[model samples]
Target: MTELDSTAFELLGSTGPFAELVSGFNVREPQLRMAAAVEQAIDAREQLVVEAGTGTGKTYAYLVPVLHSGKRAILSTGTRHLQDQLFHSDLPRVCEALGVQPKLALLKGRSNYLCLHRLQLTLEEGRFARRRQAAEVQAINDWSGRTRTGDVSELSDVPEDAPVWPRVTSTADNCLGSDCPSYRDCFVLKARRRAQEAEVVVVNHHLLSADMALKEEGFGELLPGAEVVVIDEAHQLPETAAQFFGLSLGSRQLQQLARDAKAEHLREAGDMQNLPDSADALDKAAADLRLAFGQGNRRLPWKDIRHKPEVESALADLRSVLEQLRTWLETAAPRGKGLEGCWHRAEQLAHKLARVCAEADGEYVQWLETYTRSFAIHLTPLNVAGIFQQQLARLPATWVFTSATLAVGQDFHHFTGQLGLHEPHTLQLESPFDFQSNSLLYVPPALPEPNSPSYTGAVMDHAEHLIEASGGRAFLLFTSHRALQAAADRLQESEYPVLVQGQMPKRELLRRFRELGNAVLLGTSSFWEGVDVRGEALSLVLIDKLPFAAPGDPVVQARIDRLREAGGNPFMEFQVPGAVITLKQGVGRLIRDAADRGVLVLCDPRLLNKPYGRVFRRSLPPMPLTRELREVEAFFAAGMTDKGEQARA
Candidate 1:
C-alpha cells in the first residue's frame, strides 16, 4: 500500500506513463480524486457511488486503481460495445501502462456464444427459410471449425441479428450441459471457466444483473469470488435489475421450447408420435395467443384483457397445450438427456406461465406486452430494492457504481433509493470541459406544448434553422417514434443528407453519419443515449421534448399508481428526476471533448412554462442558455470563427 501510494502521484501526472503512452491524455484533478476514492473504497471493502460527469476520463480513473490494487474484481459496463471497449481497449492499455499482467477475461450472455451442439442439430436439419440464411449457416459452420472462443462476434461478415444465430446459439432451456456430446467444446462453459479463473472479469449490465437476480441459478461462479465490483453506467442498473428480478413468459421462449422439443423428439423418441404432436400443439397455441392481441402493438395491464373472450380462450389453450406437453414429456423423459432437458424446461415454463397468468401479486406489477408477431406476459416487481439488497448482502464485496448522469441537481436520492444502497459513499465530479463557453442551450420561443398536434412541425421549423447554422452535423432526438417519423417526413427535400433511425442497423447508421460529416440523423429514444458522435461529426443536438417515460406504459403506470397509493408524489420524485437524467444524456452528446463545441436546442416549452423546469435547469451542465434565434446563429458563427483561427495557427 505504501509503495503504491508513493507512486500514485507520478503514475497519472502530466508527464506520467499514461500521458506518455495514451493519445490525448490529460492530467485531470477530478480523475485523480476519483481514483483515490476508488482505491480507498476497494481497500476498505465499502460500497461507493460516483456521478463522474462526461470527459472526466472515468474509464482510466477507476481502471488505474483497480489494476494497481490487483484484486479479484468484476467490471460491469452499460452495454456490449462498452464491455468490448473496456476489455479489448482500455484494460489492455491500462495494464500495459502499469506494467502488470493480471489475468483478464470477457464474458457475455450465453446467447452470444456459438453452441456446437445446436450448430450440429441445425446442420442435421439442413433447412433454412431463405437462400441467404442457408449461406449464413454455411459461413457459420466454416467459422465454427477454426474459431477459438466461439463468440459469434468473431464472424463480422454475418449480421448479429441473422436468423441463423438463434439456430446455432444455445439457450438455458436447450443446452444439454455435461450430458451432451459437445459438452467439452461448449463455448459458454469455457467462457465461464475462464472468468472464474481470471483476476478481473468484464461483463455487461444485463449479464451482471441476471446473475445478481438469481435468474441463472447454478449456472456459473462468475460473481462469487469477486472482492470488488465496479459498475460503470450505474444509472442504468436499477432498470436492468427490475427487468431481471421480474418473471416473464414470452412467445419466443415458448416457441423455442416447442421447436427444440420436436427436434429432439424426432432423434430421441421417434417411436413416440405423441411427443411431436404435443410440441406442434404447444407451438401453435403460443402463436394463437399472440394472434389474440391483434395487429397493433401495445402494452397493457393484464387485468385489462384478462376477461376478454378471445384472449381468455387463447390463454386457456396455451396452458392446456403446455400441460399436455409436460405430460408427454414426462412419459418420454428417459429417452435421452435431450428429452430429459425438454421435460425440465416444460416444467419450468408451465410453472412460470401459471404464476404469470394467475391473479396479480401485490409485490409485482402484472403487465402484458404485444409486439407485431409476439406477446409477452411479465410480472415486474414494484420494487427491486429488497431483491437487490439481498444479493448485495450475499456477495459482501466492495461495490462501486459510477455514471455521468446519476444525480439530478446534485441529489442522488432518485438513484440510491432505487437499489437500496445503505450509507454508501457518494461523489459527484463535474465535467472538466468548459461547457459554459463551448456550448449553448437553445430553447426556441413561441413553440406550442409538446402534446399539441402541431408540436412536431414547430420543433422541425426551428431544427432546420439550427441545422443550417451548424451545417447539418446534428442529431434530432425525439421521445417517440411517431415524432421522429413525422420529423423525418418533413426533411425529405432538405439539401443535407438525412439519416433516419430504422433505415439501417444502428451501428451502420452511426458509421454513415460519421463518414458523411454533415448529415442530420432523426432518431427516437434509443438514439438519446449510448450513441456517441464526437467532433465535427455531430455538433448540434435537438431534443424534441423532455424524455418522460410514457405515462400510458403499463410498467410506468403501475409504478406511478403504487407510489401514489403510498401517499408519495410520483411526478416530482420519480418522473422528473428520471427525465432529468435522460435529458442530461442527450445534452452530453454535444460536447464530448474539451476541443468539441456545439449547440443544444431543447424544443420542449415545458422547460420554461412550468415551474418544475428549475430542477432541470440546475441539473444540466453550466452552459450558456438562450431562447432567442439570433443568439443560436451567433453561437455557431463564433464557433466557425474559432475553427478558422485554430486552422490558421
Candidate 2:
C-alpha cells in the first residue's frame, strides 16, 4: 500500500489551507482514523467500513484523500440536497484548499436537469396548468441563459417535488441521445459527458444504484470506471439498495404519462382515439389492484396473499399490459429527427415500466401506500441482503461505507450482515465529542406502553415538559406520522412555536424552525437522522418509541419468517438491532459541536418494560441518565442560566 505522507499530515495538523478550512472544526482520533481508512481504501483497492460518529467531519476526511490521490473516484451521497451542497459548496472549498484543480462534475439522477425539448413541447402544447407552465417556462428561460451545468436546482423557487419539473426533465428511462435534434444541447447528456471526462464525480446513492442496475441502458455505468466509490450516509444503503432492486408503480406516474401522451399529440398514431382507451385500461388495472387488495391498510407478507388467485392474476395482467405497451412503444418510434426525440422518450418509459414489472415477483411484498393526495403500488424485496451481495460481487471497485449509526452496541455485525458484507474490513470509531459534559440521556419514568391506548398522549406530556425546559427548542421524533401529527396538534396552542413536517416542504420547515430559534419541531422517519441542529437552538430530542420496522410490514414479516427457518430469533436477530441503530441516530441529533449540550428524552416506557432497552441505551453517547422529569428540566435550566450569564459577562 502507498504510505501516507507523515510530513503532510503534520503540516495539515499545524498550518496550511487544510488548517484554515478545518480550524473551527475539532479533529479527534476517529476523524484521523477515517482519513487513514479513506487513504488506505484508495491505495490498496479494498473495501473498508468506518462508522464515524456525528460531527466527525466525515465529508472532509474523505475529500482530503480524493484531493491527495492521483486517481479518479466518484462520491455518492443519499440525498439531492447533499449532492447539491457537495457540488456547489463542499467540493469547491476543499479543492481550493488543496490547490488541486481536478475536473469535477455533479451528476444527479437525470430527472433533476431540465430537458429543453420536453419543456418546449409541453409549453407549446398548452398541456400544463397555466400558472405552473408560466413559472416553469420563466425558470427554464432563466436557467438556459445562465446554467453551465444545466442542473435545475439553480432555481430556488422550484421545489424538488414539483410535477411541472418532471414533465420538463428527462430520466434515464426517457432520454433520447444523438437521435434527438436537441442532442447537441441536451442537459442530461451534457452533464454525463462532463462526468465522463472528469476525474471526480459526485452522485447520490439512488443515481449510483440506477447506474448499477441499468448499466446497459447508459454510458457503460456511472461509477464502474472509478477506482474508489465512497458512500456517505451509509446507514441508508440497505434500504436504498432494496428500492433499486425492487419495483414500484405510482398512480401519479401512470396518470401523468396518459395526460402527457394526449397533450403532446403522440396519441395520434394509428387508430388514434385508441390511446385514451389505454388510460381507461390503466384506471381499470388500478381499480382491479385496489379491489384485489381490498382496503389495503396494513403491510403484510406476500405468502399471506399468494393464496388469493384473483389478486395474483390481477398483478399478472397489469404486468402483461405494461410489457405489451413497452413493446408497442419501442417498435412505433418514428425515424423523423423532430419526432424521433418524442418517440425515444415513449420507448424509454415503456422499457423502465417493463423492467420494474419483471422484478415484481411473489418473493417481494406488494402494498398500496397512500399519501394525503397520492398513492403508489410498492413492491419491496423480503430480504435485500442476498440481492445486494449479488450486485456488489460483480463490481471490482473498492467500496467504503461510513455512517455514525452503522454499528449497534459497538458491533458491526447487524449492519454488515444486512448488506451481505462478510469479512470486509470493519472499524467502529468512537465519538469525538466529550459526551460526559456535552450531553445527558433522560428516560422519563411512568410512561404508558407503546401498545397502550394512552401512549401518544403520555409521550406528548413528557415532550411538553422537555420543550418547556429547553425553552421550546426540541425535536419530538415519533415512529409514525399519525403519532407525529397528534403531538403537533396538541402542541399547536402551546407557548412555544410548533413546526410540523407536512405544513410545508422539509427544507422550508427547517428554515422556519431555525429562524424561530426556540421552536419545537415534530417529525417522523426522515427527521430522525440526517438533521444537523447544533448548540442551544436544539437542546432536547424526544423520541416517542423505538423505531423498529412495523412487524406487520410485508417486507419485515417476510424477513422475519426467512430468519425463523434459519434457526434465528427474529426479534433479537432483526428487530432489536435495527431499532437500536435508529434510536441512536435520533439521539445523535443533539450536540453537534464542542460547546453544544442537550438532553435526550426517550418517552418509550418499553425501554424499561422490555429487556432489549439496554442495547439501545448502550449504543448512545455516555451521558448522565435520569428517569425523573424534574432532573431533566433542571439540567436544561442550568445550561440556559450559564449561557445567559456568559452573554451578560
Candidate 3:
C-alpha cells in the first residue's frame, strides 16, 4: 500500500482540494481531524468509533479515506436517503476530487426491487380490487418497461406503502429464483451481482445486518471479500442487529405461505388430492390465531398468554394445521422444483413457530404482538452484544462505526458495551459551529415533573410562548404520541399553521413546514432526529421530556429484568445514557448549518431536580444555558433587530 502524505490529508481540510471541487466549502477543523483518524484506522486495520457532531462533514471525511485507500469496503448507512445521497452525490464528488475512479454499486433489500415474475403473475391474475390499486399496478408496470434498475423509488408517483407493492415485489420465502421464467431479468439478482463486482458497495443497516446474519436472499453473502466496513449512523446499529438476530413469525407470512403453496400445488401437482383443502385449513388456523389475541394492538409476554385456555387451544390447532400442510407438501414433493421450495418453506416455518412458541428459556424473551387484523410471535434474545461480537470476530476487517450522537457526557461505555466492542479506538469531535453564540438551551423554571398530571399542560403553555416568540418556526418534539396530540390540540387556537405528525406523512409534513416558513410541527420520536432545516425557518426546538424508552415496552422490560437479575443497575446503565443520547439528537436538529441560530426548550423539570440530570446537560452541545423565559424572547428579538440592521445597511 502506498502511504499517503500529510498533503493528502491537507487536501481534505479547509483551503485544500475541497475548496476547488466543492461549492461553498468551508474549512472545518473537526472534519479534517476526523478524516485523519479514519485514514489511520483504515491503514492500520483497527476498529474505530467516532462521534462527529453535526456539520462536521463526516460523510466526505470517511468517504475520502475509504475511496482513496484502494480497498474494497462496505459502506452501510441507517436510511435509504443517506444511501442514495452517498452513492449518487457524496461518493461521486469525493472520487472526482481525489482523481480516482472506483467501481461503486448501491444495493438495497429485495423488497425495494421489482420482481418481474411477481409483476407478471399479479397482472395475469387481475388481482387489483380497487381503482387506485389498479392505477398503481399500471404505473409500476409502465416504469418497469422503461427502467433499467427496477428500483421502486424511481417511480415517483407510487407511494412506498401502496398495497399493490407487496403483490409485485418478491420476498425470500416466495421467490422462485432460477426456476422462474424471469430469472434472467431479476432486478434483485442483477443488483447483487453488480454489488459483488464493485469496489465499494453502499447499503443500509438492515441489509448489512441481514448480510451479517447470512439471511440475505438466495443464501448469498456480501461481506466476505470486503476489507473494511464503515457503519454510518452507528447509534442505530445495536437495535438493528438485535432485530436481525431475533426470530419473528407473523400471521401475514403464514397466510402468504399458504397462498403460495396452494398456487404452486395447483400448477405443478398433477391431481394431488387434499392439497388445496390443507392450504385452506392452514389459512383458517392463522386467522384463528389472530382472533385468539383478543382485541386492540398490544404486546404480551408468553407467560401471560400461555396460561389462557383459548390461546392454548388456538396455538395447538395452528400447529396441527401446519403439520398437516407440511405432510401434504412433503407427500407431493416430486411435483416440481417450485413445489419443493414451497414444501421447504412450510417445514422451516412450522419448525420455527414450534420452537418460538415452546421455548421460554431465560436467554430469550418470547412475546406476541397483535395488530388490528394480524399478529406476530417473536423470540428476541435478552442481549445481542455477545452474538454481534461473535459475528464481528468472524469477519477479519477494519470496522468503523460513526454517528452524530454516540457518546453521552464524553463517555462511550453505553454505546460500546451494547455492541461488545471492548477497548476500540474512540474519538469525540464536537461541532465546530459557535453553539454558545448561535444557540440557547432554555429550561423554564417552575414546570412540573415529567410524570406529573399537569406536566402536559405546563409543557404546552411554555411551548406556546416560545413558539409565539419565534413566530411558529419551531418543532415541538414530544417523548410520546399522547403528549404530541395534547400539544397539538392546545396550540390549535394559535394564528399560525400547526402541522401534526399523523395527519400526513413525515416527508410531506416537513415539506409543508418548510414552505410555510412559520408553521409549528408537533411530532414524537420520529421528528427528534435525522431532520434538518436551516435558516430562520427552523429557529426553535421544544422537547417535552427526556426521551426515555417506555418501561412498558416488552423489549425494554425484558432487558431491564435481565439486567436486574444480573445485579446491574438498569436505570443508570441503560435508561439514563440512552435518554441522554436521544436528547442530544433532539438538540442537534436545531443548528444544522454554521449560520443557523435557534433556541432549544427542554420542558422536563427533572433536569434540575435530579442529580443524574447533569449527564444530559453535559452531553448536550455547549450552548448558552438559561432558565428564564425573557432571555429566550430577548435572544430572538436581538436576532430580528440584527437582520433589520443588515437589510438597511
The candidate that achieves the highest TM-score relative to the unseen native structure? 1
List residue ranges in candidate 3 displaced over 4 A. Answer: 1-8, 218-220, 265-274, 331-333
lDDT of 1 by residue, 491-517 (tens): 999899999999999999999999999
**Tens digit per residue, CA lDDT, model 2, 1-649:** 3224532343245455676765464545566667777777777778888888876778877888767785788888989989889888889987877878999988877777788877766666664566876776777767776887678788877776776787777655445567555788887888888889989898888887666655633545555678888888888888888877766766566555555554444533544455445544655665576567656355554445645888788777766654544444444445233333434544554555455444355467665564544455567776778877776777677788888888888788988887888777887877778889867888888876788989899887877767877898888899998898888789879998888988898888888888889998888988887788775778888888889989877678778887898899999989999898888888888878888888888778778677888888778788888887788878878887898999999
Q: Could you tell me how far off, in angstroms, the CA of residue 214 lies in candidate 1 after the best superposition?
A: 2.3
Task: List the candidate 2 regions with Cα displacement exceeding 4 Å.
Answer: 1-8, 15-17, 20-25, 129-133, 216-219, 264-271, 276-363, 372-375
Q: Assess candidate 3 and give its TM-score to the true structure.
A: 0.96
Ranking by lDDT: 1, 3, 2
How good is model 1 by TM-score? 0.97
Which parts of model 1 have CA positions greater than 4 angstroms off?
1-9, 215-220
lDDT by residue for model 3 (1-649), tens = 2223544468776557788879998887788788888888888899999999999989987988898789999999998978998899999898898898989999999999999977876776574578899989998998998999999989989988787888889887788888877899999999999998899999998888877775655324668788989999999999888877888899988887787777676667849868878888989999998888899888878777876898899999999988998898988878877678778889889988988888678888888899998999888887778988998888878899999999988999999999999799999999999998989999989987788999999888888889889988999899988888888889878999999998987888988999999999888877888788988889999988889998988888999998998999999999999899889888888999999989998888888889998989889888888998999999999999999999999
Error of 3 at 232 (Å): 0.3
Per-candidate Cα lDDT values, in order, are 0.88, 0.74, 0.87
Residue pairs whose backbone atoms clash in candidate 3 = 14-27
Model 1 collision count:
0
In model 3, the Cα lDDT at residue 237 comes to 91
Global local distance difference test of model 3: 0.87
